[model samples]
Target: MVVKKNPGKTFEDNLQESIKQSNEKIFFSRIKDTYIPPDLRQKVRVTKNDYDCMMFARSHLFTLELKSTKEDRFSFDESIIKQHQIDKLLEATTYENVISGFIMNFREPTNKVFFVPIKEFIDYQYIAKNQIKDHKYKAKINKSSIPIAICEEIGIEIKGFKKKVNWHYHISDFITEAINTYRSKV
Candidate 1:
């Protein structure tokens, strides 16, 4: 089935449409923040939830944080994915049948997408950090950023077709990979 990309649609919008076309049983929604008026100020407190969207398919719930960057690498130091977001994702993974992760879109020069499970992401962070600390390391590693090569190694590359309007990503592939990974862990 062809999932057409609309001209002004956001990444989440396209993803929702793709999920809809992928499976009849799957449901997707973009989480929106409750608007708080400026007048409330100190009277009302709102905690930010950085999750971009959620999906329910085949009795499994998925919380996804979406990020699109034109750059070749996503920088940890630059806070492309915030600390709170990381905490939320990690927390979600502690539960059963709850798959939480990130969908990173590398745009422009490389129109590629990847679904990185939280555990793998954390492990990669540890490796990156250790590589930074090791002065005798031979391979050139960027201490602050996760380059595309590393993303390909640690994450599942989402396949897609580029149409004249936009890209039609196979989101089902991501769902399958996530479920498989989760099952393997369990």
Candidate 2:
């Protein structure tokens, strides 16, 4: 019997590959140490619209939407941000005790990271849109642009002038940082 290939299968595969490549033990370890929740199986699931990954560790829940590019930077066109993407991110925010975020992993010119809190990220998108309307914004709305803006605005992890980041280390680092930062907020 022949089997059909899922159109989204490639995207899902890439997402899982990135996660699998990253130091998952450290990711879970950090989450485990930082938050005191019941023991539960770690689950990462992909859905059509809601989130790229719905990660559950015991009772700790995290909604992660991932975007990747071979470019060296994060900034992209606002058109790339789909309505459903924003809608699902917004939905994650309403849930209590859930951490929702957008993760950008750039694979060119060396891997770079941007793990942004979803609520604040959406808020900044509006702010960025307004800023563009008010003035002639020269920047493209890409992966890194608004996220970097919000990181600076909110005093999160700063990916400064440093151009190169080791992907293996950085992915784990980003996950560790995201878990810790959001865990503190709630």
- Evaluate model 2: give its lDDT: 0.52
- The sequence of per-residue lDDT tens digits that candidate 2 reaches over residues 66-152 is 666664444536554566766777787677667777766554464444666777676566656555454322444443355433444
Q: Give the winner by TM-score.
A: 1
In candidate 2, the residue pairs with backbone N, CA or C atoms under 3 Å apart (3 or more residues apart, or in different chains) clash, namely 74-143, 74-144, 75-142, 75-144, 76-141, 76-142, 76-143
Instruction: Assess each prediction's global lDDT (C-alpha) against the native.
Output: 0.76, 0.52
